[model samples]
Target: MTSSHRKGSTEGTNRVRDGGAVHVSPLELDITWGGDGRYWRIDQDRRIAELIQVCWLEVNGSVEMHHLQPNTRYKLEFKIRLKPDAFGWNDSPVYIMAMPGKGTKCIWASADLSKIRKGEQTCSIPSRLEFTTPSSSVADDKMSFGLFEIWKGRWKGGLVIEEVVISKV
Candidate 1:
């Protein structure tokens, strides 16, 4: 993957668009939603759950940050949800991995996603989050990090995700 580092602004920020193909920030890794099973959504039980068709595609991108002080960790959080009236996470953690110096495989560092307790159909909560990025000391070549939907150790249930954020650890 390629990266473009910009001057200033170490704090991770987001830019929102209305429609069409996505736009990427000059300094951030561009993660695209090409050919992921996410497009095939499961229908919610109409009698018990509210049928919500998400207008926004949600946050989509990569964790390849340029200008990161070599070895320093960058943490990211993605807030999500499953059902409208649902409250609780899948009891699973998010998995994060980094590839040092343009490697094909990602070195694993996990980001555990918390539960969804608060109500905010139009807002994001920290509980329902995928926590990634750690204060690391493995910087040698350009590093890249990201979280995965599936974790290795446990079984997952429920839904997680509402919004996303990126920052330094």
Candidate 2:
């Protein structure tokens, strides 16, 4: 797959750190759901970008974006709320499968972050997620990119997501 990138001070790719040195935004997201309420604006929360100091969202609901890199290598670190025992706020959240409509897939997944860290290049893996890029994750002939279009249940009273980060390999 080609390394599709957008250059500019875009909403989720800008990072000015340590006296104006701009670093590439290695992480991005469309956080439609989480512990906090959904916010359409980028300046509202940190759950939006788990790493690389980019855009973040701290809420719960639905979010959608397009032009995701297709049939390629990628990495995502997410701290998702797991299925709490009989709790309404429980969230063993599964990232909304970014299938043909989004041109992507999920290859691997693990709620454990330590394992994901073995190959991650930047940022620490979150202890709350299991992610993958395999096409057979949910259904055949499909792929899952960490776009987070859907979240199971709600983050009514707990920390929605501790962190989330993603990169195209």
Candidate 3:
């Protein structure tokens, strides 16, 4: 795993055992107020982003389609953990949005974090947002994706983001 920052933006890449996976650290994501210490606590040493509290939630990222194996299927997931005292998730629904590449139709899927128990034990299970890549590479190289809970306008807290993984299915 390796991570770097460019112009205040974070980018990370990690190789999984399958040799076709990319692990994107939380710091690499375009998080709303991610750089602000008041709303997010970024621990460079641990390579994790912990959300202190926020009303407008948005965590976005992208990767070059070329980096992935051609004609392959993949699933995108966020590795996260909720503190025992986490709150404001009772009614709000978070959605995962993805666009395989430019000019492609965007897709959305709900990630039900509501039923997940808050604790260290449940952290091992990742919050999944499934999307398959295009069967072949397209003219546009970038595939944009994100996690959002903005519609509810609810203040949520105690969410810790480890990384987002893109792996072959």
Candidate 4:
């Protein structure tokens, strides 16, 4: 069996490794209105965040490039699930975006949560918003990423964010 250790922390961001993949708990993300009990319910025991209600949905996270293997491709994704009574996602399109650092081009990938929900027959609603990490010229650059659905002005709820997983591709 293999075990991993906490690499260290920067501004409350603690990087943990599972093999070469980094698992970022929901508590590490910068979720809008996350501190409000009315909007979000954080379960520390489960290490997940559940959305009660929100008009603007913006969940963002970042990691230093040095934490990942250099010159290698990777996929960043959010491991999430939608409650059965989930609302406000039919027309609103959520996007998963990523950028290596400042002044770099941001890559976007449309996340179809509804499609995933419809296709699954089981009670499990686990889904992912995945994006390919853009290569950076500087090895020490910080990579910023997020799942956004703020443009439509829709009120959404029933989102359960498990964590952000970044793994080599």
Best by TM-score: 3
Cα-based lDDT for every prediction: 0.36, 0.31, 0.74, 0.71
Please, what are the lDDT tens digits per residue for candidate 1 over residues 5-100?
Answer: 112123443343332111223223222231223422222232011212221222224433343434444444444445544422345445544453
Q: Which stretches of candidate 1 lie over 4 Å from their true place?
A: 1-60, 81-83, 86-93, 100-114, 121-143, 150-164
**Per-residue alpha-carbon lDDT of model 4 for 1-169, expressed as tens digits?**
3222111124555465777788777877777777777888878788788888888888888887667765566777777777788888888778888775666678787766676573213332233433444455576677788888899898888888877878776
Q: Which one wins on lDDT?
A: 3
Cα RMSD of predicted structure 2:
12.3
The TM-score that candidate 1 achieves is 0.37
Every candidate's CA RMSD: 11.5, 12.3, 4.5, 7.6
What tens-digit string does per-residue lDDT give for candidate 2 at 1-169?
4221221123545333434222333224333322222322232344222221112212221112222233334444444432222122223432322233234433433232222322224434343333333332222232223433133433222123334334453
List pairs with backbone clashes in candidate 1: 31-61, 71-139, 79-161, 79-162, 79-163, 80-160, 80-161, 80-162, 81-161, 90-157
Model 3 agreement with the true structure over 76-157: per-residue lDDT tens digits: 8778889898888888878887787776788878866778889875343335555667777765577788888998888999
Model 4, position 153: C-alpha lDDT score: 90
In angstroms, the error of model 1 at 140 is: 15
